[model samples]
Target: MSGKGGDVRELLAQYVTNLEDDVFAIQNLQGVVGAVMARYSRAETGLRETLLREFVKEDKLKLAKAYKLIERVLIAYGDDSVGELEGAHLSFENISMLATKVIEHRRIGGSPIEQSTRYVRYDFKDPERGYHYYCPESLKDTPGEAVFRDRMDRMFANYGRMWQPLNQWLERHKPVEEAVYDLGDMGSTYADMADDKARKVFERTYRNDLKTKACDILRSFLPLATRANVGLFGNGRFFQHLISKMMTAPLAEASHLGRRAFEELTKVIPHYVKRARLLDYTAANERQMRRLVPRLVPELCRSGRDSGIQLLRPDFENMAGALAGDGPVSAQRLSEVWADEEECGFLASLLFTYVRAPFEVIRQRVRRMSREQRLEIYDTYYGERVTRRDRPERGIEFGYPYTFDLVTEWAVYKDLMRHRMGSIQFQALVPDMGFHMPGELEEAGLGDIARETVALAEELFAYLDAHHPTEREYAFLQGHKMRWLLGMNDRALMHMLELRTTPQGHPNYRRTSQKMHDLAVSLYPDRARRMNFVNHDPVFWSRSDSEARQRLKEQALEGDETAS
Candidate 1:
């Protein structure tokens, strides 16, 4: 990521230079390699002397010596932290949506950016492959291959067929967007596109908005095998764990891609990821767990079906009695719910760092204690706090975790799952239950076509059930319905809701975020005070303005005087 005379270069950061088919590690930066940095910290020699002895140049090291040092200290001594010092960038192009989920599920140590369906058109066929979806390497040459190919071709064809009517209807329903012919002082965000150049961009943004809407509705007709690109950036430690996990994934594609990633990364950072292998114990344990995993009665799991969101953690009716002392389990539960918000907050903060007993037990004891005792505990614990960074302890985090069982659209679930602050799980993508009918799509008079697509999808999925069951998931459309369960603390919950409910958020997810906020607020009324940041208003032509602003900001950064 090297660039000249910009924020990146100003920071004195340098990137490894490379040519085609060439990838290499950073021998050193500022005369300190990752390998020597470890020894440099522990060495008796002075910094100046260490620099001269370790470096082949003022800011680099001899490649052979650096390799030897890393091999001896990192590989032989089994020092894993040394691997974390170096990072790498990896990108996967034209990967199936199903496979992208497995890689993007990592909660930490990596950041990824995937091409958004909101912005990109998925209707085109690859010139070489003849389709926009991935055909499994395993399914090739089998009887199912012809069936899979035929069905996918029909799915994308239906996707294309619906586009024309949807777009024409959108043009009629929402005509020309308001335009800004001039950018006077560059202070106004709304004045649509300010200057003439930006005006052209804003016009294009309006046109693309129609495309986005049509894509959203028709996306339901495309299958999960739709291919998109993703780029991931992480340290060696992150890749090591990811490589090991993917190598053991049940999907053959996952295992093959894992090997491919490891192979490419080895050329740049070899020793750091040397131990990323599929261990026998790990594979055997997974196999045993799969056998022991019990499937509860499906009907019970499907209770309260057809609804969008259901709060499961604080099932007040089922839990109110157990917690109110009428039953033997009154003094139990994970303290998912509390009687007094203030006291829960106080005790949760006071004895938060200690008190290793059950939370409900502690609350019962809190009822027996005096205010002075609680105050004394709190004061003793936090009295020495001198900065804002002395933030709240982890008790609130553990105390207020909430869970929801939601029947959300596949597209919304895809966006929401990218937020890994919570525990999220979903069932196999299936078309039987029901599907969403985007209002615009129905109004556009394409309702029959949408339903027909789902019917065809169900028919194909049924046939695959007999032939290739797992392969049937590739048949699920973006607007198809699936049940997802999510559990997270209040902080993470609020963050997800606020961010996803923005004016520019996809309508599918914005509605879901609003419902989540309403449910959570109704459950914990006190939380509503701080939850005012949630955006509930709709802004027509929102993305165009945002796009214009981003373009102008980039222009300003690039020293374009006309931008301002």
Candidate 2:
């Protein structure tokens, strides 16, 4: 191994050795390391195959079974939360040996994942590759009517020409019929083969010609998404990240496909996959509120007589020299500590950042609310507007608290502009921002619509390449519409949270609300203190409109039955 490879192995060793909490590593360490390892070793099929075979033989199991054992060993070893095992030294040696080979085989920043746009280039012309099943061409009557048919036909013909020679060459040495049968389909022929055989065949088959053909198709026809998944082995964590994004997203086909993938993966690795947790903010438990308040709003500690006030705690009912009771003090609101836009914005973004645990913590509070309590909380907290019509009943809406909805952000901004807020705060358009605002922007010229959204937040991905070039990273920025709600008070927030944190809520809203909750507690632990009317006190919040809620319940039941 070279000096740099040794350094990496050493770093990895220290990382595992120093991992503090095993439980913390339940998913994070194994996930990050596994992902990093996968990316780093992705191209090193030979090395990976060697390790897999050796590991499997040692574990005395089939490939899948051995893979699981290896995963278990790494997870247990990498996890600091597992406590010290009796055979820690022996296990470490084994893992270290594996890590060394992995590091030795690592490329750029260490990941061996390829970046060629060649072999799978033709895949871009495949509509199914984009995860969009309902192409306008698919429904057309004629076979040649599809936009990609001509290009695809040419690709197949070209590929056949290229592969024909190889097939003939193989036939000269072996059986011609078997060679002809073996190259059934260019890409998927190996799908039916064993991993070893597939690797060996593809290592030879994916020649310059194949890559050239792939690049030709990719550069011409494929969307970025279709070309992205080539030569990749996405681990559970990556899927978790992908699923989180797609869960509440609007792309019906992609989201459905992603969900199905998640379902299948969960079946294979049930212990590793975390099922989505449903949360409702308004119906949050007051007790948890009281407990979490200390962490959220420590300043509340000084608000009462027990806090430093001259409170009378008389032994007798009429004690002469007793401290005077300072009657109930108003709970300290989040604004006391976090009145600034920067702090609030930072928190808002954090909530939407989509880290799971913190997201779930806030989500649980939202999920506990009864249906009626949610709307009442909304009415009490939010300023009534036409956009209130968009709020989903019964389920938590995504993007609550921080911003009700991305659409709501635009609508609210438009309303503000109508009243002349535009002079002070004009909306800027972001170019090529079409993927996010699909339904809303579909009617607008795709390019023009993209131009309407301002690109205030550039992806921080460039930094990843600098510090860890070998690592794969993805990131996004909050638009101005969502960024402005940082300073919104508890009332505006309660309604937002109530709506967004439910299943019926928009997915982005749900994610955003959780982000806001996480930020609130993390940023200003002093002021955001008590069980407010809308947030913690679900009992009272729901009481405001019991009848309207009953009607909603009836309507929902009717709708459900009608759908059935």
Candidate 3:
């Protein structure tokens, strides 16, 4: 081995030996040295090797000195240096309200996997454990605690009651294939099959599907305080930002989470995240909003009223059929095409950065260019030839701007909200717009159950709306419709369309994306053609087979059972 490699191996070995004698500290040091080693292996091999050698050969005093030097350098280097190092997996067990806030911290750029309400049965409870909900520390000694606890208990009871009936309904109405398949048809029932494992697998699959539908219907009744667990994976820099924001957040739960997360994270990757601190700006922003909002528009602050989507710009006269009713409308009917004079000006502004000459000269040159030449330039800028490394020139995309007034389901809106490039204004959640029932639930003969559950939730929401308007949204399901006005350029739309139109995406959002694409094409046919990845098809993709294989492997390790 090379001298550098030998030194690394020795240092690692000594570190391990030291950790063996200090088991408690090993947990704290796990991601720190690993992250440092990874970065050094890539770029700072010589410096890393020298530091390791010095620490391994020197006494306790020297080792402490080395650690302090490393800490100072990391803190001084700021976000860029620490951003390169990843954090260890951090586990969070909290209420759904806090989980949503944590997941919505997009600035962290972390990937999080939370417990699925679709697949997991939250109704299972032990008498000793009690119903799962978070109680704020301030509520402990107050009379309001009794009221809060009683309401939460009632919600859980309603949620539990729906499960059994929903399951029975699904079983009775199993698909025709599941009901009538012969012995040879593996795609359907396994009635003639003698294999116990195959029978168990079939039962498990059907049960899971039934549970998913039931949970989807019942989740509308669940309070924001319902307990949830999430596994977060982020880099050290992301954790620093997350910790800072969480600490500065207005919610008491967020502050509690921030402190707890910081304690655990600092133990693992101290150097990378040592500079994390709550920002004064975040607090000031929240304070200003609270002070200014009610004073300026007291009537606007009223709750429980439906704030449906509205189109303020693009001339109301031009919107013929799109703004007719509250129901879903075709994109073609909704948008107004820009006039020739207006379009020319818009296109010039978009191409402003691309022009090499002065503003007036470029304006004249763009006006003179042939239609074919303009199209050619756009094609060359964002074409099939452009690799991931070589993004299209930003100048070409500056010309196409589109805006839409959208009324979509809360679930669909959540997916769209992830696209940060768009300027979106959302209305408060309300059930007056109605809810959507999944086609799968309808197919399984549980449409009535789904509809009735939403109605029940709306009834409860009405009560909360009158008594506590701010908390009424807790009763909203994924199917509940919400309105939002979206304003974005063509470049943002291209990215949104390419992603949301995939076959794997939810059917509702896929329809939304398809409509958006249609609108774009209707207005700017030449530019719309450049967005090549928008897919609209009946095909579906799933990871169920791989998941089944993994389950089988786990089962095999537990016993001698074999999967056919």
Q: Give the best candidate by TM-score.
A: 1
Which residue runs of candidate 3 sit more than 4 Å off their true CA positions? 1-51, 58-66, 77-79, 175-194, 293-407, 413-479, 483-564
Total backbone collisions, model 1: 2
How does each model score on lDDT?
Answer: 0.65, 0.30, 0.56
* TM-score of each prediction: 0.75, 0.24, 0.64
Model 1: lDDT to the true structure: 0.65
The Cα RMSD of model 2 versus the native structure comes to 27.1
In TM-score terms, candidate 2 sits at 0.24
Report backbone clashes per prediction: 2, 43, 1
When summed lDDT is taken over every stretch of 10 residues in candidate 1, the lowest stretch is 292-301
List residue ranges in candidate 1 displaced over 4 A.
1-32, 44-52, 55-60, 72-77, 177-202, 294-307, 314-400, 539-542, 550-564
Ranking by lDDT: 1, 3, 2
Candidate No. with top lDDT: 1
Per-residue C-alpha lDDT of model 1 across residues 1-564, encoded as one tens digit per residue: 233434432232233333222344333352125665566557886433343456444344467776787788776777767777777889988778878887887656788899888777766777888778988787899988888888788777777778888888878876655333222345333355467765555566557767776665666666778888889988777888788878977767778888999999898878777888874444654344233222211222222234567664423453465467644553335253454433644463334223222223334555555767666544544445453423332233333456665777788888998886776655556665578877777888888877777777777778777888767777777778877657688888889988988877787788888888888887787975477788887754445555546556665676666555
Q: Which lDDT tens digits does candidate 2 get at residues 1-564? A: 124324333333333443333322211232223322332233454323333333223322244544454355445443312111111000111111112122112111111233333333332234543321122222246432342333323333333333334333333433312221123232323355456744454444433323342232222122211122212234444444344444443233334444655676555443334532221221233223334434432432231110110111112322211222534332343233223222232332222221211222223333344545444444432323343222222112222232221222222222221111111111122212222332222232233323222221122223323443222111121221221212244555445555545542233334445555545544444433331221322121111133224334654686699999
Score candidate 3 by TM-score against the native.
0.64
